[model samples]
Target: MVDALDGRYPRNWAESWDRVGLVLGEFEHAVARVLCVVDCVPETVDQALEVGADLIVAHHPLLLKPVSSIAPDTFKGRIVHRLIRAEVALFTAHTNADVANPGVSDALAARLGLTGLRPLAPAEGAAAGGGRGAGRIGELAEPLTLAELTALAAARLPATAGGVRAAGDPGRVIRTMAVCGGAGDSFLTEAARAGVDAYLCADLRHHPAGEHLANDGPALLDAAHWATERPWLDDVAAWLRAEFPVDVVVSDLDTDPWTVHTASAHKETHP
Candidate 1:
């Protein structure tokens, strides 16, 4: 497990300001039945309990910043306490996973069937070896209409109430594409510089997306943030299962934070 983490997410790839890698528990601890999740929330913890998971390998850190206490009064404290009581270890890859070869962005790109991929913005302080950046730019196998690509994304990613929202000319043929697993609004200019025909990611706000689309920028496909990052969970689980003699379980907690509740009248009308 250590070797896999080191190979994929080198320590140097993590930003100095970020806290990643193993957050809870020791490496030597016997971890059988691991849980893979995007975030280590209470719902995911309950799923881990249901599956009897000993460890949870997540993309985002549960405790990124230092905490003064674990008194169970605070939400984070309660999570920490719960994991400790359950003997469940927690590990996060974060930006380090983003820069890995088959990292978060690569996995997302593959889902989109993109080819000839390269980094949209290469991360700084990457080890001497070749590693891409947080986001990747690539091209589709063949040009697809913007509407078609949007359909493909919706089909590929996990279904959510948010569905898949797109901006730009629906009929515009998109060949070159860029993708980031989560919250890629900051990379708009970088994707623009890469000259991609479209950008697929999550957590794009109204103002930013509107401004970019108004400028005739790359077509945008915004997905649920959790769905975008969930692809990495499989890779993480597989790596842990292969290297360590452990059972890995992908959390099915649907912890996307957006609850879908249709009013009875609305449902009746729609039905």
Candidate 2:
């Protein structure tokens, strides 16, 4: 499993601060049942235990930062103890998977039925070519108004409490678009440079988004971070099942952190 993952999503492709790859367990242990999830939190861990998963292949790492201890009393430490006791291994494929050709954004783009795909920010060195990069730019099968595209995105990507919102003219037509799963405001300039009609991502800050629009960048569609990335779990699961004898199960749990969303009180009453 580790070898296959390494070959497909090499750890070297991850960013310098990213703590990806195997986080726990002896990799040699037989893994007949595997659960793929966006986050490896207590709820997903419970799901893994309930499903009798021998290994947990998560997108987000449980330990991204240095920790002094792993005692059961602590929050993450408690999960560490639970996994250790249950003999379930944990592995993470974060930025590496994001940069893979048919990667996270590829899955996101596929959900929107995008065509003629190319990297939004092309990579450098060994992983440069072969469609490996940060985000993706592609032509929509057909053009749609910005509002229409926002609705399509909401209908296609995994449903989240926060839903989807757009930051451009509701009637603005969109043909080509760029997409990056998770927080992707960092690529605002790249999307602008590509001159796509729109860009879809998550966690778009108010200032950055407003500024991007001021510069006449691509229209923005911001969905929940977890919702944007959930499609990749399905893609990775299909690949894992095809390549290995393991039973790959994708988690249905929504771990987006934002559980409830509603219009502001003023808007609720005034509108």
Candidate 3:
């Protein structure tokens, strides 16, 4: 299973800082079932165990850095203990998966029905490929209002308490758009430089989003991190099924951190 994924998303393509490929489990273990998820959160771990998954091909790496201990007392250590006890293997394909031809942002662009897609921020020294980039920029088939775009995003992405939030005129017409699957606030300038009308991503901070709007850049749409990345699970599952006989499952449980939201209203003492 690891070899199959490595063939598609080569470990060499991953960023220098990224800890990818197999993170746990014995290499000799025969993987008969696989679970895919954006985050290796506890809930998803339980889901993998409950469904009798022999391997987990997660997008995010559980052990990204060297740890001093794995005594089963720490939080991440607990996850390690659980997976090891359950005899489940773990693997990651983070940035490498993002840069693949039909990668994370590509899957997102497909979900939004985008056309004429191109890289929003192409990586340096990357070989000739259609989608070797940090994010994707594309055009909508028909322009829609910012509100409409927000509605479309909410309807398409996995549901979470974070829902969706936009920073621009609600009636602003949006045609060209840019998207990054997770925590894309870093790409705001790149999206603006691409001349998109809107930039859709996850985890937009207040200062950056506000400053971008103040500078008359593209409209911003911030979604839940898990919601934005979840679409790629289907693509991964499809690829896995084509290469291996494992029964693939994509976790539907919402693992986004934010759990609730409340809209503010103007104060008026009437009662």
Model 2 lDDT per residue over 87-127, tens place: 99999999988889989999999999999999999877657
What lDDT score goes with residue 51 in model 1? 91
Sorted by TM-score (best first), the order is: 2, 3, 1
lDDT of 3 by residue, 1-271 (tens): 7788888888877888989999899989999999998889789999999999999988988888889998889989999999999999999989988888788999998989999888888865542465687888899989999999999989988889989999999999999999999989889999888889999999899999999999999999999998888999999999889988889999988888889898778777786
How does each model score on TM-score?
0.91, 0.97, 0.95
Clashing residue pairs in candidate 3 (N, C-alpha, C atoms within 3 angstroms):
none
Per-residue lDDT for 1-271 in model 1, tens only? 6556766687678878777877777788776688889999888888888899877778888778888887899999999889888888887888888878878988888888888888888866653346567788888988899999999999998887787889999999998999999899999999887888999999999999999988878999999998888888877777777787878787656678876845456434453
* Candidates' C-alpha lDDT: 0.83, 0.94, 0.89
- Candidate that would win on lDDT: 2
Most accurate candidate by TM-score? 2
The lDDT ranking, best first, is: 2, 3, 1
Once fitted onto the true fold, the runs of candidate 2 whose alpha carbons sit more than 4 angstroms away are 265-271
Error of 2 at 225 (Å): 0.4
Worst 10 residues of 1 by lDDT: 262-271
**Cα deviation in Å at residue 227, candidate 1?**
0.7
Candidate 2, residue 57: CA error in Å? 0.5
